[model samples]
Target: MSGIVFAIPGDIDAPTGGYGYDRRLLREWHEAGIEARHIALPGSFPFPTEADLATTERLLAATAPDDVLLVDGLAFGAFPEALAARFADRLVALVHHPLAMETGLKPEAADTLRRSERLALARARTIVASSPTTRATLETEFGVPASEIVVAAPGCDPAPRASGSRGGAPLRLLAVGSLIPRKGYGDLVEAAAAIADRAWTLTIAGSPDHAPETAAQLRSVIARDGLADRIVLAGAVGPDKLAQLYDEADLFVMPSLYEGYGMVLTEALARGLPIVTTLSGAGAEALPDAAALKVPPGDAAALAKALARLIDAPAERRQRADAAWAAAGDLPRWSETARIVAEACLRDRASARNAARGFREKPMQDQRAREQD
Candidate 1:
C-alpha cells in the first residue's frame, strides 16, 4: 500500500538516457523488494498538447489521496497548474534537468516552461535532481529550497574493461546520446573533421529519431567536411552492441552541450575507456581530468585539439584509461541508487505519517489542557 506510482510521458523502454535510467532504477528497486507500479502517460513530452494535459490530469486525479505519486519533471513541467490543484501533498518530482534550459527552444517557450517547471517543482513534497549540478540549478535558478531537493545521481553497471586499439592506427572513437541540439553531435562531428587527416574512425551511436533535422544537419556537416566516409552514425544500438562498441573503441567521446548527469560518461568508465569530453553540466563531475581530456563546450577547436592529442599518443590514452578504470571503483552502482531512492521514499512517508498522527492528537491535547485549566 505504501509503494511508488511511477509515471512517465512516453515509452519507458525507449533507448534515451533518461528512459534508460528509469528502466534501470525500476529494475533495481524491484530487485530490492520495492513494489513500484508504473504508469505510462502517453504524450510527445516537454511539448504535450492540451489533450495530453487533460489525460495527465485524469491520470493523476485517479490516484488515491494517500497514494505516493512520483512524477517525472518532463510531464509536470508542461502542466504545473494541474499539479498545484491535484497532488501537492504526496508528489515527488524526478528532474533530469530544467526543461527551460534545453537548447533550441525559443525565448517565449523557454520562459513558459521555466515558470511552469518552477511552480510544479514547488508543489512536490520532495524533488530528486539527477546530479549535484542539477540539484544546485534547481535550488538557485528555480528557487526550490535546498532542504527539499535530493541529488540521486544516475547509477552505473559493471562491464568488461575496454580492450583498446593496442597502440595502433585507426583509433576508434565512440559517442552515445540522442541526436539533439543540446547533445552537441554537430560540434562533435565538426571537431572530428579537424583530425580527418589522422588515422581515426568516429562512430556516433544514438537515436536520430529524436531530432531528424539535427541528425540531418550533423550528416551535412560530415559531408561538407568530406569526412562522411570516416564517421558512421550507428543509430541507437542495444546494450550488447554498445558494450561491443566500448570493447572495440580506443577512446570515448561525448561533446554534449549539457547533461543532467552524463550517464554515457559513467558507461564509458564502466568499460574503462579513455575519454575526450567537454566539461559541461555533469560531464566533469562524471569523470576527473586525470581520467578524461576535458574541453570547453561548443568549442570545436578545443574539442578537436583534445581529440587529436589522444589520437596521436597511445601511452597517454592508456594512462588516462587506467586512471578512469581506477576511479570507476568509486562510481555509484545501480543497487546503491535503488537503496538511496527507497530510503528517501520511506523517510518521506514516515515523516508524513508522523505529521498526520500529531495533527490527530493536537485537539485532544488542547482539550486536556483546557480541562486542567
Candidate 2:
C-alpha cells in the first residue's frame, strides 16, 4: 500500500468549508490507518504565477511514482494540460466545485477557467465531487464520463440543540460562511434591513480576509442602513466560539450564491437550529424543505418575507428546528467521507498496476507465440 499524497493549495486549516473539508478528510484518513500525507502548494492557486507553477511542478513531480496523487481542484483545475497529462494514470481530482461557476468572475476569466478545468479533469484517473450536484455538473457541463466521478459529501458532527434566546431577548440569527462575493453577504444585509421593524439581531460568523473589498462593502451597507447595533460581524471565529454561536442562535441563515456542498447547513442542523437559506447550488438540496424556509438566491424581498414568517411565529420556527434535529441523525460522518476517498485511491492504484502488468506481459506472450511458430 503505497498510500496517497494529497496536494492542496493554501492553509489547510483555513476556516472556509473547502479547507475545513480537506483538514478533516486527512485527519480521518490517518485515524483509519490509511497512509495519507499532505503536500502544501503555493496559495496563489487557480491563478498561479510562472514561478509558482514551476514550484508546483517540482513539488508534485517529487512524489513517489507508486503513490496515488490526490489533487485539490483549486490548483488542479488550473494546471497546464501537459502537467495534468503527466499524472493522468495515477491522479485523482477532488473538485469542491468548478472554478468557473464562482460568482463575480468576469466573462473572459470564467471561460478560461472552464476550458482549463475541462482539460485537467479529463486527465484524472478518478474525480471526487463534494456533492451529487457537483458530479452532475461535471458530467454534463465538462463532458466527463459519469463513471469517473464519485460523490463524497461532507460530514457533520452531532451537537446539542441550541438554547436560543430568553423570553425577553430579541431573536438571534446567525449566518456562517467566508466573506466572499459568492457567499452573498451583501444580500443578507439587505434582507436583514428589510425586517428591521422586527425585534431581531443578526450575527455573521465568517472570515473577512478572503475578500477585503466585499467585507468593506458589507460594512458600508450596515452603516448606510443604520444596522450597526443590530448586526454583528464576528470574523474568523474558532470552533468553540462557532459552537457557542450555534448554541445561542434561534435561527441559522445562509444566503450563499452557491456551494459545492453546504457543510455549514449540516453544522446548523446538527445543532437543531431552524434555517432560512437560499436555494442555490448544492445548498438548495442539502437539507429537506421542512428544515429551512427556502428562497431564491439574491432576492432580498423574498428572503425578508421568509425571515419575518419565522420571526413572527416562534412555533413554526420550533417546528422547523425539530425537523432539522431529526434529520441530523442521517447526516454523513467524517469517517464515511474519508473511507470513500481512501477506497477510490486504492482502486485507482490497483487499476494502474494491472494495466502496467498487462502491458509488460503482452510482449512476452507475443514473443513466445512467434518462437512456437
Candidate 3:
C-alpha cells in the first residue's frame, strides 16, 4: 500500500513545544511505515500577508488528493476560507487550541480569530484536538459536532532518570512556559513571594509572548517582595539546558489559565519532578491522582500553599514524583499517534468513496423513474 503524507506549516527549526510535537508526530508516522513529509510554512502566520497566502496556495496546490494534509492550528487560523472550501473533503486539522482566542490576543483580534476557528472547524473533514479539555471547548464554544472531532492526546518522550543531590538544603522550584499573563506568571511570582521565608529558589524559563506589561509588573513584584535574588528569570533555555534544570529542580509548577495540551507537564513528569499546576489547562489531565499538586487558576494563595506544602515535606514530594514518573512511562509514544492518524485517514477515505458510489446510483434510479412517467 502507498504510504500517507502529512503536511504541517510550523517552524521546523524552532525547539518550542508546538514544534517538538509536530516533529515527534512525523517521526512516529515514519516508524509506523507511513511516508510523511512536513512543509514548513513561512514563520509569519495567523496574520500572514497576501504574499504569504500565495506561498501557501502554491504549497497546497502541490499536494495530491491521495496525501493526507495535516494542517497545524497556528497556520490554519489564517488559512483562507476559499482554501478550506477547496480541500474540505481531504484535510484534517490538528488544533493545539484556539491560538487567536488565547488571552494574549487583543480583544478585537481574539473575537476575529474565534470566528475563523469556528469556520475552519466547520469545513474540516476531521478535527484532531490535543486534549479532552480542548475538545470540549471546540464543541461548546466553536460548535464543532462531537462526531467530527477526535481527541488525540500529545505524547511525551521517555522520561529521564532523576539525578540530583538528595539533600536537606532549600528545594528548587521550576516553572516553564512563555512569560505571559495567560500562563499566570504574575500569580507564580506572588506565590514565590508568599513562600520567600522558606529556603527555596524559583527559576522561570521562557520568553514573554503576550502582555509585555507583565514583565515590568513582575519586576516590580520581585523588588517589592524582596525576592529578586531568589526568583531567577532564565529566558528561553534549549532542551539540554531544560533537561539539566529538570534534573536539578525538586518540583515543577505551571499555573497557566489554559492550554490546548501542556507538553511541559509531560516533560517534567518524564524527568521525575512533582508538578503543581492549575485545573484550567490540558496538563491537569496529566495528573491522574495525587501525583501532582493541583490549584485553582489565578489563585496565588492556593498556589503558594501547594508550593509550601511540597517544600516543607521532602518525603511527600519524592513519593509523588516517583508516582508521576511511573505514570509518565505509560504515555503513548509518537509512533502510536502516527498509527492512529493513518488508520483514521484510511477509514475516512473508504467512507467517502462509499458515499460517492451511493450518490451516483441514486441519480441513475431517479432517471429511470422519470422515463416511466
TM-score, per-candidate, Cα-based: 0.91, 0.92, 0.86
Q: Which of 2 and 3 is the better model by lDDT? A: 2
TM-score of 3: 0.86
Q: TM-score rank, highest first?
A: 2, 1, 3
| Model 3 Cα shift for residue 250 (angstroms) | 0.5
Considering every candidate listed, which one attains the maximal TM-score? 2
lDDT, candidate 3, 1-373, per-residue tens: 3334455565574656677778877775554445568886876778777898788878877877666677888888667788777878777888888876576677888877887777877888888887888888888998989998877787666645667546775678888877777788888988888888899888898865434687778778888889888888887788888888888888899998878888888788877788899877677865766689898888999999999999889899889888887776565555445555555554455643432332344334434443453
Candidate 2 lDDT over 169-201, as tens digits, reads 999999999899999988889998988999999
RMSD list, candidates in order: 10.6, 10.9, 11.6
- lDDT, candidate 1, equals 0.80
Q: Rate the local accuracy (lDDT) of all candidates.
A: 0.80, 0.87, 0.75
Clashes of 1: 0
- What residue runs in model 1 are displaced by over 4 Å at the alpha carbon? 166-169, 347-373
lDDT by residue for model 1 (292-358), tens = 9888889989999999999889899889999988877666766556555555554456643533342
